[model samples]
Target: MKYRSESILLLACAALASACGGPDGDNSEAPSPEAAEQDAAGPASNDMPDTAPAETGEASGDHEEADDDHAHEAAEGGRLESHEHGHAMLAVTLQDSMLSVSFEAPLSSLGAPEDPQNAEDEARIEAMLEDFRNDETIISLQGDAGCEIVSTSTGTRLVSGHGEMQLDYDFDCENAGGLEGVRFGGFDQYPALLSIEAVFVSDTQQMATELSAASPELKIQ
Candidate 1:
């Protein structure tokens, strides 16, 4: 009778262990072979490397439409070019507290600069940039508004294809609310810059002024 009871107890314990088994008696679930194989065959992910951004000389402001569709070829005020090298184009636009001034000029008009292939030619360009950087007179704004140049973007290079050179200048101004006038001092620095066709637009007025060596200042109302 004692042997019989011991055998019964052992059988009951085996039955309880089998009933409590939760798929291999472990808490973690095992992955199916099909799911594992699919994960193994998943697509490879390649990380892209960082690259330098392309240069674009876009300024913030509304582009003034050409006064005439054929204005480019037409000369105004007896000048040889209505839109060509010997002259520079200046545009100043104001929106809210932000002020921006954009300047464009022909490379040849800077002087008889040689093609910038050698060190000496490069130095000449560098000198001009230094002058512009130091000149507070280049674009004088009404001082009452406390306007100041915060950032300047300028680029100059020779183009072999058209034998044309270009200089682009963009200045971001802070505290430009009281801006009332501007004076282009390029003529004072580069004698070749005879005149600047300027378009000034602000909250109160839209004006077109031609600044020259003779009359280099525009007073904004």
Candidate 2:
């Protein structure tokens, strides 16, 4: 009887050991193919560096374009509008021998010059106009020949002439008093009343003509 009990105890121990070591005993599942693949692919937190110079170049180009557009809009009075081409309007009326001159630029049509040199040129022209307005000689001409600036703005100038002959210049006519007309002597001659118009396009001769016309006989000293 002692030998039989010992045998039964050994058998029970063997069965418990087999059950613990069985394939389905632990209740754990094997890794799926997809999970294995993701592990092999590396961690989700890693970021790779960009390798293409072309992509960098494209990004730079886009930035430059945006900057250019911004500059153009800013220079163009804060908006984009269609420009009128090739014509300045001026209104000329004769009251006496003295000629009153009024002038203006088409702000809507005036574009920001693309080249820096060209921009400087435009600025010089603008300065010349301002100088003319403040010139004692030019003012004297209006008194002698009879003309004066009554009012002025970026887009317009009003002048009244009074001398031997009263001449009024209301240069608000189309294609008669623009930058082009102010720079070129295309419309500098007008009988008893001096109807002068100049266009501002590369030539300085218009400035000379304008000074001469302003005071027909004033010396440029």
User: Cα RMSD (Å) per model?
Assistant: 31.2, 40.5
* Residue pairs of candidate 1 with colliding backbone atoms: none
Worst 10 residues of 1 by lDDT: 45-54
Report how far off residue 61 is in candidate 2 (Å).
35
Alpha-carbon shift of residue 92 in model 1 (angstroms): 0.3
Error of 1 at 8 (Å): 99
Per-model TM-score on C-alpha atoms: 0.54, 0.21
How well is each residue in 7-104 modelled by candidate 2, as lDDT tens digits? 22222223223222345555344343233323434456111000010001110100011233554434432111111222222222222222223232
Off by over 4 Å in 2: 1-91, 94-100, 103-119, 139-149, 154-221
Worst 10 residues of 2 by lDDT: 48-57
Best by lDDT: 1
lDDT of 1 by residue, 1-221 (tens): 00121222222222233322356554344343223322333344110000000112332221111244354323221111122556666656666665656565555556635356567866775566555545656656654665544545555533321112232333344556556676676676678767766766654445666788889876775
